[model samples]
Target: MRITVWDLPLRLFHWLLAAAVAGALITINLGVSWIEWHARFGLAVVGLIAFRLVWGVVGSTHSRFASFVPTPSAVASYVRGHWRQPGHNPLGALSVYAMLGLFGFQAVSGLFTTDEIAFSGPLTRAVSSDLVATLSRLHRQTEWWLYLLLGLHVLSIIVYRLRGIKLVGPMIHGRKEVDQTVPQPRGGGVLAFIIAVGIAAAAVWLANGSWIPVPPPAPAPAW
Candidate 1:
């Protein structure tokens, strides 16, 4: 039987987040000229993460956190090869949570970073210098962690493919073929989607430091 395992919003979120993350990584490495783009991508990530977090609550059954949050017993069951059901498995759930958390931290912390040159985060001026320095250091350090996680994520996809499971297709198309009967996904209707979009837009606005009142242009330089 074929079933809808991922809703459209979730699928869009997955791909858009991937693109934003990639853009951030690439632009950041391209030197000062690309820093602005890197910041733009990071802000995009902030919105995407915000949307996903909200969607995880009100999204369709399979996409909800309640559907696949990893429990100790569930992990044990998966390890013992007795775990069976659709959507994220217990072990995969751990990776999902870890990626979300790491990316969220990265995006939020980036709001305070400064290159001490041509680029500065939107929130850099709002925070103390010491705090900005600390966050900047952490941001640089944690970047490697994201790379590690990304590598593992791709590796896992490859491994699953080797085991005759097609993970990417289902995510792209939002459906899967399974032999066992499973309940159809529900929830995440228009109202829930609207709420999610509103939250995400607000996050982008905040991440851009739009709430911070801009200082009036300094009075024309005194002669």
Candidate 2:
């Protein structure tokens, strides 16, 4: 039977984030002025992730973190084929969390990173030089890991496709055919969506240093 596994909000978040990540990665390869765009894309990611965190709490059943965040016992049970429910499998849940963590770190770190040239993060001026240097280093170092995780995500999709599981279709259309009893999403209407978007916008604003208090101008140099 066909059942709704994802809601409009979750689906939009997924695709929009995918596009933002792709845009940021492309900017990385392009270099030069592209890094400016890369930061924009990264900020978009922050908004999406911020909304996702909120949605995970008060969103739909399948969209909720509680539905897919697995414990050690749950993972073991899934490995043993004891888990037959819908939504993310235990293994898939780990990958999902890992991806989110990676993107979250990248977004947060990018706020304070700088390339020492034309490129600087939106909030780079908000932090000390030492802290900016630290985050800048971390931002560079974590790019490789993010690529690795993205590769794994793609590989998992391919593997699942080969095994007759159509993960992509369900994510796009928000419905999937399954024998198990999969409950459709509840709540998460326009009001919840507006709230989530508001939170995301606020995060983006803060990350951009809109709320950071500006320091007073320095006095004239003593001759």
Candidate 3:
């Protein structure tokens, strides 16, 4: 039987977030000139994550955190080969949660980071210098952790493929072929999508420091 395992919004969110993260990583390494683009990509990540967090609550059955969150018993059951579930398994759910949390931290931290030359984060001026320095250091150091997590994510997909499970296809198309019947994903209709998008836009705007009132031209540079 074929079942809908991922909703359209969830599928789009997954791919778009992947592209945004990739762009961020690439532009960050392309030298100081690309810092602005890097920041833009980071903001995109922030927005996407915000969307995901909201969607995880109001999203479809399979996409909701309640559906696949890894509990101790669930993990033990899966480890004992007694658990057969659709969408993410216990270990996969753990990975998903970890990635979401780490990336969220990375994106939020970038909003206060500075290069001490060019490329200051949008929220840098809103925070104290000491806090900015700490976040900046963390932002730089967490890059390796991102790389490690990404590597593990890809490697897990490859391992699953070798074991004859077509994990990637379902993510791309939102459907999976299962031997047994599974409940189709529900909810996350237009209203939920709109709410998620609105929240994401608000997060982007806030992360851009739109609320930080700009000083008025420094009083025309008093002579």
Candidate 4:
């Protein structure tokens, strides 16, 4: 009954995304000087999701979709109490994928959007104004789905916790015990973190357009 729950990369990505999302939320709400940081954090989130997508393809057996994602009938049966799982189950995997997809969409859209004032995404100028407007609208509208997905994720965790599930522990430790057997993980946590960081940095660099410092506007002539 034992199973490798989450790869170390996935676990760290989970927590780091949580923290970055929190920071983005706070900075956005705080306004003023924080919006810049919010954009920066969102960029980081996009990178994290990108790394995850790549990892899902190249990662360990337990981390790959071939291992966890199940069919609709299987997910339903699990919900109906007809089936039990040792790892991500079925419904949870779908939710995970949904969150990743939605968030990635949100972040990518933001990059081509403009604040409708002076601040523009690094690539915003590359697109037509009409396209920028659409991307901006999409980016803003996607917030609802992001909020809904986040709520569901939290609710699922709460339900599992109430059911005496140590879900968070396994994420942190990358191991779980089921039916007297201790589960072993597939990837090394440290290696995963290093890889994740490198991927994130590359994504951010690309998004920022080489991080070439944007020069300030020239001062207005004296009256």
Instruction: Estimate the TM-score of every prediction.
Output: 0.96, 0.94, 0.96, 0.83
Better of 3 and 4 by TM-score: 3
Question: Which stretch of 10 consecutive residues in model 2 shows the poorest summed lDDT?
Answer: 178-187
Q: Against the hidden true structure, what lDDT does model 1 obtain? A: 0.94
lDDT by residue for model 3 over 1-223, one digit each (tens)?
8888999999999999999999999999999999999999999999999999999999999889999979999999999988878878999999999999999999999999998999789999899999999999999999999999999999999999999988889999888887787777789899999999999999999999989987666556657
- In model 1, which regions exceed 4 Å deviation? 216-223
Minimal lDDT window, size 10, model 1: 214-223
Query: Global CA lDDT of candidate 3, please?
Result: 0.94
**Local lDDT at 37 for model 1:** 94
List candidate 2 stretches off by more than 4 Å.
Answer: 213-223
- Pairs with steric clashes in candidate 4: none
Q: Residue 204 of candidate 1: its Cα lDDT?
A: 96
Better of 1 and 4 by lDDT: 1
Question: Which model, 2 or 4, shows the larger lDDT?
Answer: 2
Model 2 RMSD vs true structure: 1.6
> What lDDT does each candidate get?
0.94, 0.89, 0.94, 0.77
Compose the digit string of candidate 2's lDDT tens values, residues 1-223.
Answer: 8888889899999999999999999998996868888888999999999999999887888888998978999899998978877788999999889989999999999999988988878787877999999999999999999999999999999998999989999899998787876566687888888899999999999888777677799999999
